[model samples]
Target: MEDLRIKHVSLELSENQESHRTQGFSSAKLLVVRRGAPFRVSLQLQGRAFNPQTDGLVVRVLLGKLYVTMPVTFSQSGSPSSWRAYISPEGLDPQRLSVFLQAPASAPVGAFRLLLYVLTQSSRRGYKAGRFVLLCNPWCPEDSVFIPFEDQRQEYVQSDSGLLYMGTAMNIVSRPWSFDQYEPEVLEACLSLLQVSPPHMKNSRRDYLQRSNPVYISRVVSAMINSEDDRGVLKGRWSGDFQQGMHPSTWSGSGDILVQWARSGFSPVKYGQCWVFAAVMCTVMRVLGIPCRVVTNFNSAHDTNGNLVIEEFYSETGKKLHHSTDSIWNFHVWVECWMSRADLGAGMEGWQVLDPTPQERSKGVFCCGPAPVRAIRDRRIDLPFDVPFVFAEVNAAVQTVIVRQGQALSFSTDSQRVGVLICTKAVGFPRPQNLTADYKHNKSPNSTLRSRCSSVSEDVSPRTDASHGVSVSLTLDKAPVAGEPVLFAVTVTNTEAVAKVMKEHLDAQAKEYDSSPFDSFWEAHSLIKLAPLEVKALHHQIDPALCEGVAGECLVNLAVVLEDVRTQERVLAFEEFNITSPQLSIQIAGGDSLTPHTKHAAAISFFNPFSVPVSGELTITGAGLIQGKVKYSMSALRPGGRVQQQITFRPNMLGAKMLQASLALSNNTIIRGFKMVSVNDA
Candidate 1:
């Protein structure tokens, strides 16, 4: 072939002339195709034209070391589109060639490179070509073009990982967060989870198929990552009791969980809540080439019965009955897998909800789903695999009953409170996508279901006559910070022409922000008689000592109740505040300059400001900076004690690296310190 040379190359869709590539071999062009779909590539040659029968021209597709070759075909019929014309001897244009390729139904999803070669009865030399990406057809068997681009990015790409914030007031307090899944440990952890096989499954073809199937893989991963099943890897615990006194965030990423599990011989990995389980499952799904994303539902209901109602019994004093059969978490995290559900028939495919939190039983196991999000959105209660259970998580009506001793005092139903904010990582960006409205149906005004209900109503207490009026207002001292006292003031005014007597009650309670009623951290009541148009103010202080036992984040409720002695009418004023723990600062005492394979010393200092002794362990970890974990045992430091600890580590590689040190306090507080290091060969 006299050393075949090429000048330019371009790739366009088989049906259109719109080029996917303009100019360059530096970056490979992409061809998105589904299995059993026709994929064609056009190649233009500017140098020479060779006979197809004598001097064979062929195209090769390569994935890793595996390659498939197809012969270049020619016909008198010109190119299909207006932009592409046939190479003729009379014209001064480039020679044209076309190659058609087919991806079998069993082909894996990944990137494939294309190459062109010419043969003259003996040696085959390189011509010109590029690469294309073959993705699993998410819309196959049925059209699903409505799936948002954000869902596609979150579901398919491993590099774009997600984070689900825990706690009830997450939406109000915690800002949107994302995770780093490109870490080497995270990738390794994902591979390890896939390698784990079910107990009953032998190494048969069905097992192999199950390993590759996203539906089956997601279900297995949901169970295996948690120790609820024998095939599980980590023990699930909601209580904050951890072996190393580590907060859930101290473990870093999903890779940390996987590595710790394997290091413990596949035993439960310390402690994991719902968010950890969902995040780990996302890593596994993305690593195995399945589209997956982590989702967070605030005020998630755990309805015991099939009825879409979460009932709660609260005392007249606003204390929730703990023995209720049904419960609602402040927030719950789970994963959604995108795949075609041939098992459930049409309209059941797309995103399937999979909960790994070991909440309920499904098919004789503790794993939650593969339940279609579409089914939940459509309110299909009759579907199989815990569809009703998931429906209640989002669409359940919450019936709140206020009881005095044993009798019900007041009752109200709220439908919109169950799922306040349903969120996932936004597509193409590292932010939250609120899909709350997607799971909720628009109800007519005449519909029996009420989306929200007030705790107190005018019907419950007779409305005061306009002649004898009263108004109430509540205000906070400031934004509540953890380990600090929160003060609230309630003011009641008599706006009547005549003298009015009022009975005033003030209550301040610290409640779990999710669904259940919380206990009163502090309370005060005062009865006062005010003159006409007279105003009175009452104050309540929630001491830091009272909230010291409250770990992590919680909500403070300040409510004032006033009753007209003569009219028997009540006026209520309420205010809610989200109190968050103060951020702990870890001062890193070291310079940023460093060399590869050199030892570095850094000192971490923290001060104990509380009266009680504090004890915990400090963990230092980094990707390319340190080889493994560096730990320091922190003994009980007395009140007002300042402790400084020195640690040494050796850098394994070189670059701009981040070293993180997390102090997991015994009181369930996580303090973090970060330092950026620049490594040089010198």
Candidate 2:
């Protein structure tokens, strides 16, 4: 008898992808399927029939040196972490065979090489079948990453477009993000992330074996997102100089960064800050079928020494001094991934904090967490994988010090200053959902924090208050918008029954979201004399052009420092004023209804708000609506002038898509807008 030769194999891509919930992602085109799901495969034999008696059909799945072999048969039960295949009764033939292969829900996830062997009593012949990518299954309950809610699965695991909260807690800015996982370049890049990781490169078998656990996979991904230790996906640039690469704020989506990294042979893409790292990490996690969301923690702290305290020094003149290595960010963005932590026990599951911003080292690398939020809330400092680091980020006390010359004249700790508000994009909405309660035991950390982190100190001293005969308050008249002057007031009240005289210094500086205030661009110093119990509201307006920086978030760090001329007692009041860019208007040529694969036209318009002429590039990116990005260089538009760009987008895939536009100006001001378009199937 001739050897059993195989002619061809069919992966049934359409049927498998639809059932596996992987069809929306571009990975499905390469036969990507979720584990725990049964997918049909057809085989054509050229020589002889597959005889179950003398000839055995064996299926092999390989990942690097690690491989799993399963003897193909009917009704065979095995381990959940093992592969399985059964003869399909739907369609069967001697020359042609249709079999269903089910990857164990707990199987290692990544690209797998499929192979088939036909063994006879006389000989054994093997055929190289194709390869398919495997992802974690949020649909299967047996899977540790299983998410029960349908809407959550859709938002976290499937939705390609999202919002990343930025700016300060007082003025929350909802910036749109295109995860773009459906883009072909993104899918390949995300998988390539696993391939280029240090662990995968050094020990492929061990890395492949570790993929069975979501925790392991998350930790690996977090470490691979920044290029500090490993030549990872992004290179962090915190010094505010992005000349080597694109500005971190210029990135509107992960697709661009991922494609650039993969196409450059895994070269680290230049310039990623907290949001960029967190956003890209979110994209990778979601593409791999893990539920993830980008979170912004306002008043976040970076305790370099790990004492759970961020000491900030201010000159007696009210200028922030770089005295301590510790710092408090206006806002820090990170991601929270959903998974079951079997290793940490039952209650220690759900959303785990994962920071990919190349912060301090964790376990000898620069990736933070898989830190259980539950553990952080319960003050479980000894938990694994940098729980203390993440806990400090949201709970660290702010130690404010007023330095005179080289001496620290006064110091005070505000337990509730750091981690004032923690939030993420609300499910099925663009608004922010406050997660502050989840991270903090109470809004006021006075007693709660002191009880927990023996590290978090009490008020060592106090700023000038009623006891000192004066109180100061800095208030913004209205939310600051880009192109419009920032109007705010400093309210100084003499609470004492006697006349009081004080020296007031007001400072306004430009700052990045994750950085401290730079140089003061605007300042005012004046001496004021107040009668008994007199209240004074001093109004000030800052020119829009004066505060805008070449590279930084459109925010103004406005501070008012007061010193009693008689007593030398001082008080400080500050406000982080974020400049909200005017939203671009997205208008569909003919309402919102759309059809797949059909060309459609839309117009994006922006009204110049500045007193000076502005020029920039408008980039439009939509995953299902368009491929990659289309950029148009806009000429200078006079102040208060309106400019609109007409562009055509063809729906390549059907589903909901966000049509997003970002206008990056020469002045470093970024204006953005988006429209959600629902496309029907063809």
Candidate 3:
């Protein structure tokens, strides 16, 4: 009898999932393949031919203490949710053999160990079959997270760079983000993210078993993205002050945040808002092979008390008062992950909204959703996983009222305001692709919400007063640029035939971009007389001095209220606008083409648009182009002066990639720019 020994084992990662849908992560030194799909393994033996009749072979897959052992089957049948394997029919040499291993479509994702046991008549021998990572498989029809389109899978799961739509819907600002899934420490950070989850730390067995379901995994990830639940990845702050930690707006990529979190002993990264949380979650989800996209809902509603309605109130001077717990963000961001919702039935499968912003709690945890978008569109709030809360985010009616010392003078229910222009980065393009139609049923996009306010205590419905014949409107002459005076006009019209004398009050306030307005920085009052059916436009300007001293991204809330001298009736109108920060112009050399492993010249320039001297740090980062980040600190730039710096550009990968530069000013203001270039194989 000869002692059979194994000499070499190879997991053919390149032939299986490497070129399937994503980047070069599949072709790592260790095997990283998607579950529900079969991966090939070749075993080279030094001894005799394997006898399938009398001898036995068992393959075991393990994660921590939980593992499954499945024998190599000769027959072609088994359950899709069960582990199975077989000897390849091709290349059946006596000593060398090829084997195919398949895990259940719903396999727990993460690093896994494989062991092969050979059983003889008298004894058994086991061999370590090498290590590999298992991710969710969207290409496999049997996978619960299976997405149908190849283009979608490429954009959602493979593309490391993306655009997060921010600002108002009408004036959209697409923020560039590097998901950086393939970065050195990013994948490890993702795995670490799961390992540090509450469930995994509590009961490892139950957590490993539940990871197979995307529903459960998404919920856990959602809770873990924010620090309120456990020692999550990010600490949320809606306040404008970021002196204690990094400002949310300054972070342009997820790798820096994730790596810092992982290196800091799983401490939550400070100062993340909705978009930051959503973008980071998108990175984690895509790394785990879950198709995901960052979605923006402009005029997004955050309903408190869960009544399916957001209440707001305005003062006689059109000042939005903080009277209610409910609020409507100028824009809200969340991730829509693609997966099959087996728990909710058939048609519910598709893009499910998973918010990691930690605004509302589900089942006592600060996890917003994995709520089916279909269920939300149908207004089926009776479903599980905070469907009602999501339903209100998109379809909730906004009831705004004007209060004059606690009395509701007027109110309007603008159903079309909430969830206006839901969108994400377009597939294979850099522009925005509107997904608003998917969230709203038979709703017109042109409809506008005219009223604004906080919450009033009185129970009131929208009512039109016949005696109130004055129409008021506020408009910005142009988009307010940083360091410049804000110019705007207020138009007042007497809709009735009779002449009227009115007292006009205009208030301007600086606020955090993600939350409600605070105190007014500037206010003006005047008496106006309007002739019958005549309209008058009053021009106004807000000096730059008023908007200074505010930290982080700021939006100006300009509101006007008119009081009729004849009947004491008031008409209100307001406009919310953000100052467009000056961009750090990033110019790559040679126009469009860059050769891999070669040095090229690039330039980052910024013209100080501020009246005061500016001092800050500039950071340049590219995923595959360079290692971490190239940063520089500026001494100071006088007003209206231009500063240009040269950067040595080098790319290490072939394909299209983005080079981004961001300038974080001493005032906590951040401005960024990016340029896409193609890398030639030469």
Clashes of each: 5, 0, 3
Q: How much lDDT does each candidate structure score?
A: 0.60, 0.82, 0.81
Q: Give stretches of model 2 more than 4 Å off.
A: 1-4, 25-29, 46-55, 76-78, 120-123, 444-467, 548-552
After best superposition, candidate 2 residue 10: deviation in angstroms?
A: 0.4
TM-score against native, each model: 0.63, 0.93, 0.91
Q: Write the per-residue lDDT of candidate 3 for residues 1-682, one digit (tens) a residue.
A: 6856667888876775554444467525668788887788888877666776777778999998888899876654788888888886555665877778888888899889999887778768899998888899988988888888888887898888988877665456657899988887788888999998999999988999888988999999999999997999999987757888887888899999998999999999998999999999999999998999999887788888778688878888878888888888888999999988878888898999999998977899999778888888888788887888888888778887789778999876767667767878878777777777678887544322211111111211222222378887777776566777888888887899999999989988777666778888899999999999998999999887666654236677778888998798877777776666777788877786889899988999999877789899999998878778999998799999999989896787666688888888887788788877888786
- 10 residues in a row with least lDDT, candidate 1: 450-459
Instruction: State the number of backbone clashes in model 3.
Output: 3
Error of 2 at 644 (Å): 1.3
> Candidate 2, TM-score vs. the true structure?
0.93
Screening candidate 1 with a backbone cut-off below 3 angstroms (N, C-alpha, C), the clashing residue pairs are 150-427, 155-291, 155-292, 227-234, 234-268
Best by lDDT: 2
Candidate 2 on 1-682: residue-level lDDT in tens? 6678789998888888889988876444688899888888888888777666676788998887788888888665667666889886556688998878999898888988999988788877788889899999999998889999999998899989888877766666778889988887788899989988989988988989889899999999999999999879999997756898998888899988999999899899998989999999999999899999998888888888888878877787788766777888888999999999989888998999999988788889989889998898888997897888888988998877778978876666678778887878777766666677788885533322211101112221112323377888887776676666788888888887899888989888777666677788888899999999999988889887875552236567777788888888888877775776678899999888898878899999999887788899999999888877899999999999999999998887776778999998877778888888888875
